[model samples]
Target: MIRTPKKLWVMHRIGNKLQKINNIIKVIPEWRQRYIVNNVEGVNSKDLAQKWASYTRDSSLFIKEDDIVGIEDESRLLEESLMDGELQQTLISVVGMGGSGKTTLVAKMYNNETVKSHFDCYAWITISQTYIRDELFRSLIKEFHQSRKEQQPPELSGKDYVELVNILRSYLDLKEYLVVLDDVWDTNLWEVIKVALPDNHLGSRIMLTTRKEDVGSFSSGVISYIFHIKPLKGSEAWHLFCKKAFSSYPDKSCPRELELLASELVGKCKGLPLAVVALGGLMSSKKSITEWRSVYDNLNWQLNNNQMLEVVKSILLLSFNDLPYPLKHCFLYCCLFPEDYIIRRKRLIRLWMAEGFIQRVNRITPAEVAESYLMELIFGACFKLY
Candidate 1:
């Protein structure tokens, strides 16, 4: 009878083992399907990775007005420019390198109570690198009518590009309108869209943000009308960095022991608000001194290779990619120099000339061409003069 009980216990043990194996076997197909969906049958793995990175970055970097740092002066000046401008229609362009807070500053001003009260109607449109005229017109029409709480025309959906433009023009012809075009790329876009925006001689205003200085200059011919946004100053950058990095900690302050390492990491960001903010958010979850040291040590690699910092890379690359073919070569050549190396203007031009990045135009010598390229780089915010 004891032997019989022992056999039954063995059988029970075998049954449980078999049941566990069966459960695992049942899940194998589900795991296989997930692998196939993620790696083979659906979006490309690289694309999926990029999308995930973007989602993570955006979620972590959610900005509130109180969270905004280093733009108070900019906000005030931009507001004044928009609200206290000439009676004639004026175009004010906010020009800056990507990640310099052009959109943030303008968005703040666009939504200000004082600004809203000053203008009869407001329409904020985002004109990215690629825009369709008809689609833009439709968006404008909707924004203009909706801001005033007026119903759009029933036939709006049926109107063509010209009709849409006319409708917008006619609607804004009498009112003092404020229109914001964010992220403009090409000058020709402005030339085309400006026709639809009537001057109306009623202090109507148009605001645009662009990474390209030339685009800003084209939009607003006067120098005063173009606001060149700079990176955060040292103290401001540190303040902003601390705000993001220690947001969850008491008083949103960095620990005394970690302050040096944190400051070093912030310095790597070069005072670009987006970079500082993103890096801070990235460092927030890391609590140890060793982790902070690791980040500081590997920041250059992370900026180039890590997906979390991809947005920063993308923003910095915009200006680089916008360079002319020769200028692109020159800019890359400049990167060959060690960081913080003071590159003499004449020597750099000589290097460019040797590298064949400069060519003589009709009246301009190769030296002059190279000089022009350097100025372009400077104006594009790629290089800073000390």
Candidate 2:
């Protein structure tokens, strides 16, 4: 049955309210205190409230909402995993190309107030291609100390890896902590470090961000919950571009003809935010439509030379390289579609099917085959689906 708009809005509000209630219940301290008699008994109501407030403030994690673009679904999934009971795995992987906002999304989650209030401790580490165990261990320990000042002897070893791992495990034996491993590349590095992390701690969450899907998949054991970051939608793409290109949104006063051309070029970026930002920065100060056209022309010329046109070409290359052989042909064939053209999916699929890309794969329907191909391209961030 079709639901009315009012009913849908009401349902949405109720869902949000329930989520907030769940978060409050999960993060609120277990016991309430009346009065402090010698430090063992209890604290005054005002002092108790002040202490709880400090704990809540200190434990918070979140990315500023303004800095984040989309991925509300991604944020919620990570939160739920972190909030699950003891033995709940807090590991989440965010995978995408460089500059595709994997770090941004994870930062948002880590800096969220709910995350801070819920977890007992927290850590953030940036792991690069060259993995340094000592550096990572030190960073985690530093965050732990900063978050909690109980100042028990430091738990890591200076030379022995085994002793260091043991110390880490002891430090977080039963603590609920959120750890973010950012810019990860090596799979084996994770295997070595996973042992040191605490297990079965309620509300504990870990997040991983990497450019390669294999890095994310291997680290997290190919879990069902993989959040693949896609590029921006058209409106989002335009909004981002305008923010970078003009001090404000470009309208008729900002040269309608040039603005129209800029919009077309933005569409060519396939809604990738980095691409939008880079291209906008490149063309922002130009007053002539001719220069915009020049950029449009240079894009093709750069593709032919294929040496280095900075970050944009690098991103485009990654997208192209990730495609399968047949899919490559299918995508290259899309060069036939004009800039800013809103190609109909059914029509495009029929065309590809006629061209013989979608056919008798175990007798699957043509529409299904087309849909699968589209999904693959979407996953690879090569194309945007409206």
Each candidate's lDDT (Cα)?
0.72, 0.63
How well is each residue in 1-386 modelled by candidate 2, as lDDT tens digits? 99999999999999999999998777544311211112223445445433322211111122225534656777777667666664555567888765566766777767778778787888877666565676577667777766776563444445467766666787788888878887778877667777778665455667888878887777554233468988777878787666656645446133567777877778767765656655664565555888778777766566556664444554344445545677776766565442223356766676677578865677788789888987665434455333
TM-score of each: 0.64, 0.57
Query: Which candidate leads the pack in TM-score?
Result: 1
Tens-place lDDT per residue, model 1, 1-386, is 45688899999999999999999899877865543322212344445434332222212123456757777877887887876757878888889876778877777787788889898998987676667788788888888888899998777768997898888889888899989887888888777887788878889888888889888888543223888888788988898878878989899888999988887877777777767766675676679999787666666555677666444554344334545798877876654443333467887787687667897799888899899998766544455353
Total backbone collisions for each predicted model? 0, 14
Highest lDDT against the true fold, candidate: 1
Clashes of 2: 14
Score candidate 1 by lDDT: 0.72
Q: Per-candidate RMSD vs. true structure?
A: 20.0, 23.8
